[model samples]
Target chain A: MEQNACCSRREHDLQRRVRAFAEERDWGQFHTPKNLAMALAGEVGELIAEFQWLTPEQSAEVMSDPEAGGRVRAEIGDVMIYLTRLADVLGIDLADAALSKLENSALRYPTDQVRGSAAKR
Target chain B: MEQNACCSRREHDLQRRVRAFAEERDWGQFHTPKNLAMALAGEVGELIAEFQWLTPEQSAEVMSDPEAGGRVRAEIGDVMIYLTRLADVLGIDLADAALSKLENSALRYPTDQVRGSAAKR
Candidate 1:
């Protein structure tokens, strides 16, 4: 619980800070869901580009290379920022959305049915 | 603060549930950080695929279409799951990582230099 509180405090602070930054700059007018989604996809592509030709073994060591690690982390940060902004703009509660989907997924991929299967449902 | 506590409590429970689900099924062996990252990218691709053919206007209305919206939300949930797991495996705190990057981005793209530029820094 203590750990969770700490996580929440940091997350909550980041959320507040992000919102304030955008608001102060009057950027919300440009943060339509579509633009945010496209920005997210572009960032995801950039992250994948870093691993495009690497063998699985090489890819696995991505974080060991400080330069690649920094790039990967920055891309991940971009992805999260857009995602959070999109969800906020849409009035979606991310935690609730995730929890609900997880419940559905838990049912969809029951251990008895999905064990040892790589098939996506 | 209360609202944040709620998000934390739910997020904490969901994290526990996800870990237990994997442990009970003995799927941890396949969940190497590289594999999780790959899976996250794939899911992000799927999410983007939904918006690929749409114009900006259509993409903005994506959520109005129940079918597309459901798929998009599910993909988002998948992305979050993989991200949470990967961060856990890497022993990185998502909130902390995001905050540090946000700080850096604020410095790199300060309003005075980059406002309304739409240029990647």
Candidate 2:
């Protein structure tokens, strides 16, 4: 499929590639929302594990170091893979969904109210 | 300051409010990368805790039930609040940053390769 002009080329491209892979192997059957969500969480956990116990400075460095960065990127890629898949499985346009969510969030958190306060709503 | 156009009105608006709140209390000095990062982690931990023991179905319900949903929203709000603040402090345009990241991801995950496959890179 050709990429959408308005959508982020990278994400849309990735989504398309991932979808084709699934189509070829007939893996959509295993991608139920629940399972996909679980997969997303698992990937997130792995991402977090990469930073566990690392100081803030150290964590920042991890992203700059080739080996550590590769791991981080790989884990992040996994999370996004599942996320994009979940979005695809549910028939959501990833870009549109994100844009809409941001729109809603703008209403929920007015800049004037949220600026620097760490106060939870 | 007025809100920026081409940005999420809600996020920019919230950021403005938060910034004003911070300015009012002179808290900018406290929002260093290290401290803010820690606060972010704490908020994330709270968000994760909300779903830790719940079954998938139960977790879904948690977001729909008024009480549970409210807590979930609060935690999410907390996370976003910190995230937005971090972006603000670092002079990032959150929407723009997201857009750029998505663009980069497209190159990394070509649609032909990624479709439907859950294979991790």
Candidate 3:
């Protein structure tokens, strides 16, 4: 699939804004791609913590509770921010990478072959 | 800043595509929000593993190596797919959530107050 021009522009705008935000506070010095990737892991850890110990049904309905929902949303945002920064620092186009990976996944796990099974083929 | 219309549409479209991908393989049963969040953590772990024990400079330049770069990109894609799926399961607007968090971060870490420092305010 072709990358949408508008999406590309918006992603660039978002990256610029994030870069500016860090630059404004001289945080760029601290934002090595390694640090950002680790930070991304930390944020994902927090996201996972939100769902920890919840029953599957409860987790699926987590957003129904305002407080838990807010925490989850905030963690999600943190994860995205760090991930975006890491991609930018590494000169990777995140959206393209994701789309390409999805395409590869589709090929690797064809529907008919993988249906109802979690085993790696 | 208001969420761009095109960005919102793109995010939703991506979410739908992810959802359909899982549904097609009868994988929805394994995709509870908790499972997705944990899977997200696992992917982030893989991303961090790529940079582990490298000097900061080497970690920063990880993508200079084609093989390492591909692994990093694939890990990033996995993280995003699981994150996108988690948000979808919980009915979260991920872009809105990230923008909101960024706005909050701006307020929490004012440029003038936080400049040249890594301290969280």
Candidate 4:
């Protein structure tokens, strides 16, 4: 794919690409929702590993290190790939799913109630 | 607040509650964007910690265990709380932010290109 082709792409598009990539290889059979969810969790675990035990400043440096940053980015991509695929498999429009959740959140966190709170009631 | 009052609320509402909880306690001063981001990362770290090295089956059990599940939920709540606050501080509508990202993804992941793929490029 052209670099520019992905430059303007959104999360769902990346997800689709990953899914298509898998499908082209006949990997869909392996992508059961449960498995996909596990894959996502694993990728997230990888992401966390990148920063494990790092001080805040070191964590910042990790993001700046080409190798570490690339690894982290790849892991993030992996998580998103599974997430989008799972959403697609479930017939969910990621955008709509996110928006609906946001709407519900708006009602729960009225400005007055959640302007700067950190504690859970 | 009444449990019933919170039962019907959304993610944004929960975020709002957390933010308000902090604000009411004069904690906004501590919620700089960087700090909030760090806090979010910390919460995510905690979430991941709950399942570190567990087998997939074990992870499922963790979620089913009331104690582990509660910790995970609390961590997730912490991440969301920081995320919503960051959105609020940045003047973003979480719903709109998520929707906008989704719209971008839809374009990128046309059905023809992304039916079941997993490879990048």
lDDT of each: 0.70, 0.59, 0.83, 0.53
| Residue-wise C-alpha lDDT for candidate 2, range B29-106, written one tens digit per residue | 676544665565676567567767777666645645778655555555555566556556645554454444445656
Candidate 2 C-alpha lDDT tens digits along A1-121: 5646545544465567667655665667666555665665665567667767777667645655778766655655554566566556655554444344445556765666776555655
TM-score of chain A of 4: 0.78
Q: Which stretches of candidate 1 lie over 4 Å from their true place?
A: A1-10, A52-68, B1-8
**Candidate 1 vs 3: which has more TM-score:** 3
Best by DockQ: 3
Rank the models by lDDT, top first: 3, 1, 2, 4
Model 3, which residues run further than 4 Å from truth? A1-6, B1-9
My TM-score estimates for the predictions, one after another, are 0.80, 0.54, 0.91, 0.49
Error of model 3, residue B53, in angstroms: 1.7
Q: What DockQ number belongs to candidate 4?
A: 0.07
Per-residue lDDT of candidate 4, residues A1-121 (tens digit): 5633312234444556666656665667766544655565565566567656666556545545778655544544444455556555544444434344445556666667655565553
Output the lDDT of residue B76, model 4: 45
Clashes of each: 0, 37, 0, 31
Instruction: Give me the runs in candidate 2 sitting further than 4 Å from their true place.
Output: A1-121, B1-8
Write model 1 residue lDDT over B1-121, tens digit each, in one string.
Answer: 4544323555666666767777766677777666777787887777678778887778778788998888878777777777666665655556556667778878887887766666776
Q: Please give, for residues A1-121, the per-residue lDDT of candidate 1 as tens digits.
A: 5544323554566667777777766677677767777777777677678767777677667778898878777777776777666666655556556667778878888888777677777
At residue A100, what lDDT does model 2 achieve? 45
Query: Which lDDT tens digits does candidate 3 get at residues B93-119?
Result: 666677788899999998888899987
